[model samples]
Every structure is written in C-alpha cells, then in structure tokens.
Target: MKSLGSSCSSRAAAETPEASRERRAGRGALWSAWPRCAPRDLAFCMAALLLFCLGSLFIQLNGGPPKVLLELRNYLGESTYLDDHGPPAPKVLPFPSQVIYNRVGKCGSRTVVLLLRILAERHQFNLVSSDIHNKTRLTKHEQVELMRNISTIPQPFLYTRHVHFLNFTRFRIEQPVYINIIRDPINRFLSNYFFRRFGDWRGEQNHLIRTPRMKDDERYLDINVCILENYPECSNPRLFYIVPYFCGQHPQCREPGVWALERAKQNVLENFLLVGILEELEDVLLLLERLLPHYFSDVLTIYKSPAFWKVGNLTGTVKKSMPTLEALQVLYRRMKYEYEFYNFVRDQFHLVKKKIGLKSLLPISSHEPSFLRELTLHTPDPLEEEEEEVEEVEDDAKNWLVQP
Candidate 1:
C-alpha cells in the first residue's frame, strides 16, 4: 500500500508541470499575435471613434433654429445685392454738382451708399461722406472746417454728410442742383422710432427719459435736467415740421404756432433744387433724367439696378415696435412734425405732377409689377425651392440722406 501511494503522488506532480507549460505557451501565442495586427486594429478603432464624434456634433448644430424665408429665390448660401460679377461701367455724372440728397432714414440708405461708391469707382468720380452719428448739428466752425477739408479732397470723391442744407463754404460748382428724397412720413418716423428702440443701430440710445429737453434751450440746463423737463433734443417749443432742422432752426420751437410750418415750407421751396417725392419715386427718377439730361442717359437703367436698400434683397425686419403700444404712440406724437411735413410734401408733389402733366407716368400701385415699381418697392422674388420668400427691388437711394 505504501509503494502504491508514493507512485500516485509522483504521477500527479508530473502532470501538473505539463499543464502549467501549456497554459503559458497559449498566453505567449495570443500576445505575439496582437503585436503583429496592432497597426490595422488600432486604425480601425480610431476611425470608428472619430466618425461617431463628428456625427454627434453635426446633429447638435442643425437641431434647432428659426426659419424665415421671406424671399430668397437665389439665396445660394448668403449672397448679396451687388452681383459678384459687378455691373458694367456707369455713365458719369459731373463733379462739382452740389447735390443736396435729402436722405430720409430707413429708406434704403446702405444700398445707395454702395451704388454711389460703385459708380464713383467705375467712373473715377470723387466721393466724400460725413459721419452724422456723433454730431447732428455741425457748428459754423465745423462747417468752415468741413469746407476747408472739402477743397483738399481728391477728384471724384463722393462727398456726403448729415446736413440740413447746402452751405458749402468753398464749393464753386456750377448750376448746383439740390436733390431731396422724401418718403411717407408715417413710415419714416415709425422706422426711425423702432430702429432706435430695438436695433443695434447708432442714433439716440435711450428711449425713456424722465423729461424731454429741446435742442434749442440746452444752453440753460444740463442733459439730465433737460431730459427731466421732457425736453426733446431740439429745444424748439412745438413739433411742426421736419425742415426746421435743415432751415438752420431748432427742431423744437419755443412757441407753438403755424409760423414754423410756414418757415419750413419756405425753406423747402427756396433752398431745395429737386425734391424727389418717394411716393412718386419713378416719376422723381424721370424728373432727374430731365434735370441732369447731360449726365444721365440711362437714368432708368442705373436706377433699375441695385442702388440703395437692394430693394428685393432686403430680408430681415428692422426692429420697429417696442414692448408697449402706449410708448409707440407717444413716440408718434413726439414726431408729429414728420407726419405734418410728409403730408405737406406729398401735397406739393401732387401739385407739381398736376402742373407738369406727369401724373400718368407714376408707377402702378403696390400690386403692379412694372419694372420701375419693382425697383422702388423692393418686392422680393419667389423662391424656387420649398423655402420662405422676400420681395426685393432696386432703389434710387434716398434713404442715405436721412440716415445719420
């Protein structure tokens, strides 16, 4: 029995050693195989990981956004009004032409600037523009300074400034024709009020004031105190007309009377050369063609092209209304002068059209799609695909005159 037990123990010990050797050999084989295939295996894993991350990012980015496709038939990504290829060389208007562009704000000023700049570039005309954002009222000293500077400007300079009238200190241009652009007063005032209220545009920053101060009487009070008195920027007593500012008078009057309106009308009749009524924009252009016949052979052609506001191309709505209706009404009342002036101007324009027998030449109503109307209203083109549409039109660029 002792001999058999010893033999069994020896046999078990020998089997254990063989089994250990087999296990170690299997592990070694597996480790060696991994190294040989490591490059391809790692590459596959990394590729899969990268693709998964990219897919997640894409889904997150396009998940949610407001879609307003008012009129974007050819909206290839984010295109512009100026054709990438640009227009042909424009016919040149003479230099030294005293142009009083009565720029009405929010009427398509930017487009006008671009058009003027483009035309200047093509025709080698001088272009100079003034920054009205800071100082609406240019002092006599400032005017002198501006004139002195104007003499030094290079040829073909497109000169523009925020001016109420043309009092060029040193300009010696011949038959200097003044140009004024007019729009519906209600629309113009509303646009100006809203743009100042909501958009990031540079103009009057604050909508609320404890008091409104007038521009005329600011000499007696500080800005804070004047606002407390509810004085408007111009210290004139009453809101009567838009032309008072241009006529070298205070925007607000010290006394409320009809004289302010009469004075403004006198200024318009005497000072302005060509008042382009925006209500009769197409007719205005035709008038310009007749007035500047020596320079504008293709007045309609150039006007039909993009000038200001890129009519059909404009997409977004400028912030016009505030949170409360009462606030809006108050602003309208404050700007009542604009409404009065607008009606007066429209009436004058109608009288002129009647006098000249040009009433038949006016563009069709808002519904009509005559080529000229398309240019003035900026009605957008219909989108070919399933997206929103916006109407776009060409502009004669009266808005630039109004903008600061």
Candidate 2:
C-alpha cells in the first residue's frame, strides 16, 4: 500500500508539470493572437484620432487647402472611371488657371505679348491673343459672346485682347484672374500719337496701311498744336482713354469725370491681379514673376535676353517727340483724373513691391504734385526725324465729335 501511494504521488507530480506547460503555451498563444488593452485606453486612443481628423477638417475649411491636398483632389477628380456606367468626373484646376489680360494699347503690351509667346511654349500654357486690336468698348451682347468664347478655352489658358473691362460676375460665369499694364497717362498719349503716324520699324508705309483714310494733314499733325489748340484728337473724352480699359463697358466710362475715375480705381482694386507701370517695366516683370510664377516664371530672364532686346528695339516708335513744358502742363491739367488714377496705381504697386522686398530702381517722391517734374525726367527724348503711322485720332473720329 505504501509503495502504491508513493507511485500515485510521483505520477500526479509528473502530470502536474505537463499540465502547467500546456497552460503556459495556451496563454502565450492567446497573447500572440490578440493584444490586451484597458477599455479606457482604447477609448482614449479613438478620441485622439477623432480629434486629429476634426482639426484637419477645420483647418481645411478656414484656410485654403494645402497645395498637396489641392493637387491630390485635382488628380482624384480627373481620374477616369473603369466602369462606363456613370458620367465622367469633373475636373477642377488649381486657382488662377484662366487669366485675362485686357491689354491697354501702347502700354508695353506688345513687348509683354512677345515674351508670353516664348513662355507659352516653354511652360505649356495656352496663349490666346486676340487679333482685334481697335475695338475696346463692346455692346452687352458682344460682351456675353466674348465671355462665353473665353470660357470655352481649355484649362490653364491666358487670353489677351485690347478690350475694356468685362464684369464676369455680372454674367454669372466664373471670374478669371485679371492682369494689365498702364503707363503715365501723358506718356501713353504721346507714344500712341507717334506710333499711329510712324508705325514702329515695320516699314515707312506702315502708318498709311494702318490708317489708309487718314488725310496727310491729320497724319502730320503737331503734338503742341493738338494739345494747345484743342484739336478734337487732343480733346476730352478722347484724352480719357486709359480709364475705360478698367471702368468696364458702362457708357459713363467714356466720360472724363469723377464717376469714371472712381469706377476704374475700384475695378483695379477688386479685379486686377496686377496693373504694372510701363516706366518701370523690369520691376513690373519681377512683380509678375513673384505674383504669377506659373505664367511668368523666368519672364525677367527672357526679357533681359539678347533676342528679346533685338525684337524690342524694332518696336520703338521712330519719331517720338515729347510735348513742350507748357503743352505738357496743359495736357496734365486736361488729364487731371488720368494722373490721379496713375498716381493711385503707382502707390499701390510700390506698396506691393515693398511687401515683396523689391527695391524700386527709380525713387518716386511722395509729393503728389511732382508728376509734371517727374514726367519731364521720364519722357523719351524728342526724335529729330518724322515718320508716318496711324494715330488714334483718325480712327476714333466719332469720340472726338462728342462734346465734353
């Protein structure tokens, strides 16, 4: 019986070791299969993830979405569906893909357009330059048609034309980013006056070809006589040229007064991305590069290149002559609103330059009345020889007929 009891105890002890090993192995398997976590800990982790997601959504709503996210969204939005069961997905390009340059004539537009030709190829953006240069003011129907036409252009396109400001918001269409350039009002007038009569380096007969109907006397009209004697060409409304480009197609825009001036200034503030000064063209290009890098990247470099300069030199008006100081004073007094608008744009441009850490090559005095003095300094030297080109006066005969 003692031997039997001892054998049973030994057998139980040996089974106990095996049973313990099996239990330990089961516990290890359970641990490996599923991680153990306290209910509170799991809840905290879930709450933290939810909070992070909510914060990201809030940021995306308040601030604009990050560029990476925008690109991703665009990609997803543009992705093709494998199944042809549903309509194709809509594509939303990043902002400022559609740009409009309602170019004001003789404001270094030709030069900018020339540069854009090169940029369009390099950057792979569509450049739609309108051939219609003369007609700026358009009828309401014409505006709607033109707007629709412009909207149909493919994504990431820049459309340029010598047209007045068209209010896209008025037509319930998406507004495109607007850009333009303006020069000193008097300087612009002088440049146009000469350019029309002597049509750059294209040829001596370029002016006649442009304005075939222009009488020899009208074509050869003197700048001083035009301003001092109140020639219809140099008169009001006709002189009120640049403001209309910004003031939209309103009839009052053609009038030379506070209403037109104010509307133009407001448009410039609200719509235009940039309205550069022709006098500081290099600085303008720099600003354009900084502001709209996609369209104008390396534009400054291209402008400074030897090839661009060779092309630019050909476009300089052959017989540009500055008006006499008396005539300039007269012209200045006549274009009071024009100068005011010019000064306002200049101030705004300078502010932007300062914001972007660009130093102006020419220091502009703070005094408002120094425009005539500054004009004298900035105006091109009088050319001794006469060359023929079409003038705005001959084409815009009806505008001059209207009494101011």
Candidate 3:
C-alpha cells in the first residue's frame, strides 16, 4: 500500500504542474486575441466625447435651450419664459451738442446774450457771438460759407447772431438746435425807432456814431408822422421785420402777407426749440436753464444777480415816446401779419411753459383786436432802464431810415 501511495503522490504533483502551465498559457492567448486598445485610439475616443459636450454647451448658450430641455426645466420648478414680442426698442437719442440763437432785434436778445456770456464762463461751454449785426440776410454763397464756419466750431457750442433763419439742412450741414425771443410788434418798432435816434445811456452821440449818414431831420422825425405819412421806414415791407428772422432767406419772407406769416409759424414749430416772449424774460432764462443745462445752467441766477441789475439800471434809451392812439391804430392795422405771428409765438410759448411745470406770470390772453386796444389803454411808461451794455449798439441803418 505504501509503495502504491508514493507513486500516486508523485504522479499527482507532476500532473498539477502541467495543468497550471496549461491554464496560464490559455489566459495569455485569450488576452492577446481579444481587442487590444492602443493608447492613441483611447485618447481619440475621449477627445470626441469632450468635443460633443462643448458643442452642445455652445448651442445652448447662443440659440437658447431646445424646446424639450426648456419644458423639462419648467417642469422641474424653474419659472422661465421667452419674450416672443418684437425686437427691443431703439436706444434713446444722445443730447444735442450744438445750439443756435439767431436772435431777433429789439426783443430782449441783448439781455439774454449778456446772461449767456456769464453762463458760458460758469458752465465751461463755447459761446460764439457773431460781431456781424448788420448782415442778417446772407447770399447763398455767403450762407454756405457761414454754415461751414459754424460747423467748424468745436462741439458743445452756442452761436448767437442777429441773423435771419439759415437753413443748415438745405446746405447739407447738421442743423443746430434753434432758440429766439420776440416782443409785441408795435413795442419792438417803437424801441427801434427811438434807439436809432438817441441810442441808450451812452449818450445822444452814440446814434451818430452808429448811423453816420442819418440827417438830423430823419434822426429827429416824430413817431406819428413816420407811421401816419407812410414813410419808407414805417411802411409795410419795413414794418414786416420780425417774421423774416424766422421765415428763412426766401425773398417772399420780407413781404407782409399770409405766405410769410404761415412760413414763419411753421419754422417756429419745426426748427425752433423755444421762441420766448420778451414780456416773460425771466421765464425765458428759466427755460434755457432747464432745456440746456450744459450751456445755460444758472443763467437765471446770473441774470437776477445784484451786480447784473446794477449794470442794467445804468442803461436806458433816451427820449422814447409812444405814438398817438390814431397812429397806433393805423400801425396795428398795417402790422396785421406781425401781430398774428406774435400771437402764435406767444401761444406756443405758453404751451411750453405749461409743459415744463412753470407758472406763467403773464396769463394766456385773447388774440382779438381788443387786445391791442387794451395794450394801448394800459401802455406802460417807456423803459426807464435796460439790461444791455452801453457799448452794445445795433446797426441803426438796419433798424430804421433804410428801405428794404
């Protein structure tokens, strides 16, 4: 039995070693035959998976999520909705950088200009006040040149002149915002009438220097005679002064008729940002401050300053007299167009005042002929003082004693 057991044990050990070797060989063959993944193939598969994730993220960001995804998100307690309305509204326009004040004569422009000088300094804006007061109407070539010059002025500038309306748009130039002031037609006429003769506080000699060619007879002409006798200075075309300032450079603008009147009113509506009345001078300055803070901020404060009043009190036109009631009535009839434009401007101004939450000291009034009669009945005394410098003299030739 011992001999048989030893032989069996030796056989089993040999068999066990052989079986182990066979099993190891089988495992090695199976591993080699199965798909062998190279390092490059594994890296390529990972790169493809990464790129697909990135592309889906890009699509989600730009085109918004897919409808199914959006619905899934909403179902999962996310409250999101798309705006299927039209495209967003256009952006608001930037503020105006260029402003123009083609000022009308004898209408408190001097006062406004004086305030502007101080304002320009205080607010750090460019104020270009034209020295050419005589040439309100310019030729076409001249208009082109002038508009070019004004355009060349630096941005955020305010240019003022005693000039008629210039169509910058017609000249293919950017139009600057416009502003102006006007007074009662008859009042403006009277002020110019006396200002040409005696001038202001500088003395009677001031008129002589301004109107060197005026004879003593014409200089000293009575107001009643000038209007009643149909003198060239007081007649239709000449008395048709203020409208031309608003009616542009068209030749017909100088004519006192419906055409010029309607054109002037249209220009005021389309071009002018504000056309103030001289009677409401304070309100004009306030509006200026509100509308153009960069250019005219604190203008009313400077205008109402004690030092400004001191300078203003020292200046007044000498020997201004109102015409007789009959002469005034005749003048009113002749200036029918002027009064019509004036009334229209006043109404527009009052509307603006109401818009800006401003309380007008001068209430809106009727446009009847009775208004003129009432004006005559309550004709205030001639100006005892004015708010312009003594050295600032308008061209007497343009205002009086010259045919258009």
Candidate 4:
C-alpha cells in the first residue's frame, strides 16, 4: 500500500508540468492572432489624420483669412450650410460669416461678383446684389444708387458693388470683413475712357465730348483730350468716377491729396479683409479658391482659359503704339494721386498675402482632431465686444495714419 501511494504522487507531479506548458502555449497563440486594429478601422484612422493636417494647413496659409474662410468653412469638417452633421470630431470648422465686397469698377469687379453669385447659389448663402438683377452686373448708376442705401443691408450677406468703401464703412458689422480689388490708376482711367466709347456706356455722360474731328473708331471724346491735357475725369476722375474705390464715401475721398491716400491705405490694412490687384487676378483667384474652396471653387471654371481676359483686353485703348515717355509723364502727373494709391494698394495686397503665409497648398480632411484644433472651438466674441476691439484697431490705424 505504501509503494502504491509513492508511485501515484510522482506521476501527478510529472503531469502538472506538462499541463502548465500546454496552457502557456494556447495563450501565446491567441494573442498572436489578435490584431491591434481591424484593417478597416486602421484605414479610416489614417485617412482621418491626413484630412485634419490638410485643413489646418489651409487656414494657416491664408493670412487674410476672411477671403478664404467663408468659402472653405463648409470643408473645415464643421457644421456648414451644406451639412449640419459636418465631418466627425477633430475637424475645426468656422461659424457662418458675413462678407462685404466693395466692387470698384474696371477692377475685376465683374469676375468677383460672378464668383460670389455662384458661391451663393451652390452654398445657399444669401448674396445681396441690391441694384443689379441676377443676370447682369450693376451699371454705374445702379452702383451709386446701391451705395446710398447700403446701410439698410441686413446682417449675414455677401454684398457686392462698384462703389466706394466709405459708403459701407459705417454700415458694416463689427469685425467687418471688407474686400476690394484695385487696378493701376492710370490704366484704369484709360481703359474706362476707351471702354465707354467702344464697349457700351458711351455718350451717356456729361463729360463726353465727341467732336466731328475724330476718326470713326476713335471714339475719342473731348473728355479724352481733356484727360490727356492733364485733367482727371477730363482731369480729376476721382471727382467723377474712378479707382481707389476703397477710399471712404466721404466727399474728401474723391479729392486729390495725401489724406485720401493715407485713408485708403489704412482701410486696406485695418478694415478691408482682402485687397487684390487686377493684374494678378487669376493667381489670386487660385489662391482664394484653394484657401476658401466653398465660395471660390467655381471661380476658376469661368476663367478656365485666358480667353476670358481677351474679350476686354486693350479694347478701345491703343494697342500697338505705346504711350510716349512724355505722354506717360504727363499722364502720371494727372493721375499722381491715383497712381500713389494704386501702388499702395498693390503693395498692401502683397504684404497681406505674405502676412497670411500664402503658398501652394492642397486641401485636407478635418475628420481627425489630432492633426488640428476642433474648428468649433472658435466662437466669435459678442457683437459689442467685437465692435470695441475693432474700434481699438481703427484707433491704432488712425494714429499711424496721422504720424509724419
């Protein structure tokens, strides 16, 4: 009986070691088959990460954020006019915005207005054309009329017109986002002079002086002669109708001097959100579209070919013979104020673009938060608070303007 008990104890002890080894082997195999993440989930995660990075990059590049924001707000993976259930978390989307476009004539206002109209249609945002019908742009008269009543505009609109900035300055919202385009002052005057004769709005103005002494196609009004003779409209286009439209609506803006020049520059920096030059319209539009895909994405479609530019290219203006140095000098003198303002506008536009960190960029997704801030994190301050802040900015700008 003693020998039998000792043999059973040795057999049980030996089996215990084998049982432990089998259990360890089974646990190792189960862990080896288990995945850190399913393939679909892993793919989704990678895609989400990629989008968030891209969205962040876009906002960072556009220095004049308003120019690109309203248009791109839809894609920032937040709640937009198109989707209340914007992309999933981590996507930082901006709130709905109001934009005002002070569309100065012959400064690519048509293209800008058209782009806004298309954006309005696609995004279902309210676009206020005011005077002009949906099909055509506003005439000069209509633009002026719109300016008189610009103050009555409701909040949250993308209002456009070929009017001066002053007209809308008092009428805008706190933290207002104003945008305008400017052309070379001299060139703009010349273009308008000729365009009036050959393009459309000919013989309708008080200044037009068509004499029997000119050739048939040379719709040279006496006003053109007066303009060449060192007059603005015939000598001061600002007093009549002109560029530097970003200057406020005050009677002084149309008067020639450093005051209007400084005011225009200040407005561009402090008030206007974006100021684009006519020569660089295409590239700027491209930049705008990339920065604000929602509003300007379709802008490039109409301007697909350079041919769109040709329709009005050098029309009614002398094409072959360049203006002589003497003529150019005389013209420059007449438009010195305009030229100065134009130069300032051009410089300011580039400066703002640089400030906004303009660059070649690609749009990204906003579904992931690790790559960017939740856009919804941004809540604009109360309207009163926002106004106070803007007032501070304006005060600072005024001080700078007054400095010697």
Report per-prediction Cα RMSD to one decimal.
25.4, 15.1, 16.4, 23.8
Put down candidate 2 lDDT per residue, 327-383, tens digits, no spaces: 866786788888888889889999889998988877876333343545445545544
For model 3, residues 272-367, the per-residue Cα lDDT tens digits are 989998878889888878887788777778888999977665456678776765687678778889988898998898889889898876464544
Between candidates 1 and 2, the lDDT winner: 2
Q: Which structure among the candidates has the greatest lDDT?
A: 2
Ranking by lDDT: 2, 3, 4, 1
Candidate 4 Cα misplacement greater than 4 A, ranges: 1-96, 132-156, 167-175, 200-218, 221-225, 228-232, 237-244, 290-293, 305-322, 355-404
For model 1, the stretches where C-alpha displacement exceeds 4 angstroms are 1-96, 151-158, 166-176, 200-241, 249-259, 293-299, 306-312, 315-317, 321-336, 354-357, 360-404
Which tens-of-lDDT digit does each residue in 250-347 have in candidate 4?
66766778777887777778777677777677767866666556556667776665765554332233321223324444565566567666666666
Error of 2 at 58 (Å): 46
- Given candidate 1, what's the lDDT at residue 115? 49
**TM-score result, candidate 4:** 0.51
| Candidate 2 backbone collisions, by pair | 196-389, 196-390, 197-388, 197-389, 198-388, 198-389, 207-389
C-alpha local distance difference test of each model: 0.50, 0.84, 0.81, 0.57
Error of 2 at 270 (Å): 1.0
- Deviation of model 2 at 262, angstroms: 1.0
Better of 1 and 4 by lDDT: 4
Question: Highest TM-score, which number?
Answer: 2
